[model samples]
Target: MTPPTRPDIIQWIKRAWASLTTATILGGFKKARILEAGQAEHELSHSEPDWKALICLLQQGNVPVQTIDSSKDIKQDDAVEEDDEVVNGVFD
Candidate 1:
């Protein structure tokens, strides 16, 4: 695979940072009882561009993270695509 360019890397960093920030805030809200557990989990899970590998990359790069206010909400569209490989046509 071809290596990503500088701009590409920067974009990924921005997206990853947003995801991490959202997760952090939501997690705190859940712990503090400010938000319900299911609501927190759903918001955290649905964040577009949320990638575990990106978080590791940021840590490896020694990026310092700042906490965001839990009262603020981060909303983004779903990033995942439909998968035809998940199932086949079933008998009627």
Candidate 2:
């Protein structure tokens, strides 16, 4: 395969960072969490950039993906004005 261009490499790294962080935040203290913690720690490391961390993620290929279902629902939510506070949380 053709070598990835510099831009592609950078894009991949950014995507990897976002994905790793997301997995960590949602996965908590599972194996993915451990991996995410380590990966992020290495990335916030220096001035130039950490290509090694991205390469490691790509090489290891065990990042757990959290499946999120796309959804949208319309609903009305209200309780009451308990102590005369303005009910301005949503526009009716």
Candidate 3:
């Protein structure tokens, strides 16, 4: 399969940020690392994309950031993605 486009990666990060809390993002990052390491250890067919680097790009302002208010109530459905699927369950 072809690699995800830049826009795709950006969109995924944006969605993840919006849907997940900071703690959740941290947890996911840990999980992502584990999954990546497993792939490397087994010599998986897919290339291992640098997920932490992608997150760093987000932090460095490659994508626009939005401020959300914790005081206001949000719709549950809107607050999270229907599926918590990451690219290839890690980075595609």
Q: Which sections of candidate 1 miss by over 4 Å?
A: 22-92
Alpha-carbon runs more than 4 Å astray in model 3: 22-92
| Per-residue C-alpha lDDT of model 2 across residues 6-65, encoded as one tens digit per residue | 577768877765555533533553364434544444224434335665456545666565
RMSD of each: 16.6, 14.4, 18.6
What is the Cα-based lDDT of residue 31 in candidate 2?
Answer: 60
Error of 2 at 47 (Å): 21
Error of 1 at 92 (Å): 56
lDDT of 1 by residue, 45-73 (tens): 45454466446445654667567553453
Of 1 and 2, which scores higher on lDDT?
Answer: 1
lDDT of 1: 0.54
How high is each candidate's TM-score?
Answer: 0.25, 0.24, 0.25
Question: Per-residue CA lDDT of candidate 3, range 1-92, in tens?
Answer: 24455577778976655665544544564565523323323221223444565456466544565675545645554454545556755622
The deviation in Å at residue 90 for candidate 3 is 27
